[model samples]
Target: MNKALPMSGVRDSTYIPENILSVPPNLSMEAAMKETEEVIFGAIVSVLAKTKVECSEIGILIVNCTLFDPIPSLTSNEGIV
Candidate 1:
C-alpha cells in the first residue's frame, strides 16, 4: 500500500510520515501523536510563512483528524496557535 501511493497520484513532494513508510507500520498511539504533530505543525508553519500571518492575530483555527482520538484533545494543545 505504501509503494502504491505515488502511483495513485500522490506527489513526490508530499510528506509521508515515517511510521507510515515502515514495512508493517508502527500504528501505536505514540507514533500517531508524533505524526499528527509533524503534519499539523508543518502545515501551520508553511501557511504562516507564505501568508505572512502572525499566529496571535488569527481569530479561528480548526484541525480535523479521524485516525485516532488523542488523550489530550488537539484543540487543547497550548503552543500550537
Candidate 2:
C-alpha cells in the first residue's frame, strides 16, 4: 500500500528585526533566506516523521523563494528530509 502526504508552512516577517518596527524595508536578505530554508526544512521533516516516509522514498523536493537568491543552496534540506 502507498500513501500521499502534503505539508506546508508559512513564516512571515523573516527579515524583520525584533527590536525595530518602524525601520525601513532594508531587511537582511541573507537572514531571510536562511529563515525560509529552516522553516521549509522543519516542515518537511515534521511531515515525514508524521507520515513515516523513508528518506529514500522521497523523489522530489522543491522550494520557492524569490526574494532572496544569493544566499546559498538548500542542500541542507536533504539532511532534513
Candidate 3:
C-alpha cells in the first residue's frame, strides 16, 4: 500500500534544519546545542555588526525559550565566539 502523502498544506517548517535537527544515533545533544549556539550567536552578531552598538554596549540580554524551563536556562548556554 502506497501511503505517502504529497506533503501538502504544511504551513510551519521546523524539520528543515539538516544539520541541527536529526534522529538518534546520528545527532547528539551536545552537537545540537553547539549548532544552536552558532545559529543564535550568528544572528546576534549579524544584528550587532549591522548596528553601531558594541558587545560592551549591550546592557540586558533577553533570551526566550520554553523547552527546558528550569535551572540553567537557554540564555545560560553561552553564545558563539
The most accurate candidate by TM-score is 1
Overall local distance difference test of candidate 1: 0.80
Model 2, span 4-68: residue lDDT tens = 22223324534544323435544575555556667777788899999999989988877765544
Per-model TM-score versus the true fold: 0.65, 0.48, 0.56
Better of 1 and 2 by TM-score: 1
Task: State the lDDT of candidate 1 residue by residue for 19-42, as single tens digits.
Answer: 978989898877887788888888
lDDT of 3 by residue, 31-79 (tens): 6566567666877889998996899988888865443243466665554
C-alpha lDDT score of every prediction, in listed order: 0.80, 0.58, 0.59
Which pairs of residues collide in model 1? Answer: none
Query: How many clashing residue pairs, candidate 1?
Result: 0
| By TM-score: ranked, best first | 1, 3, 2
Q: What is the lDDT of residue 81 in candidate 2?
A: 33
Q: Tell me, by lDDT, which candidate is best.
A: 1
Model 3 whole-model lDDT (C-alpha atoms): 0.59
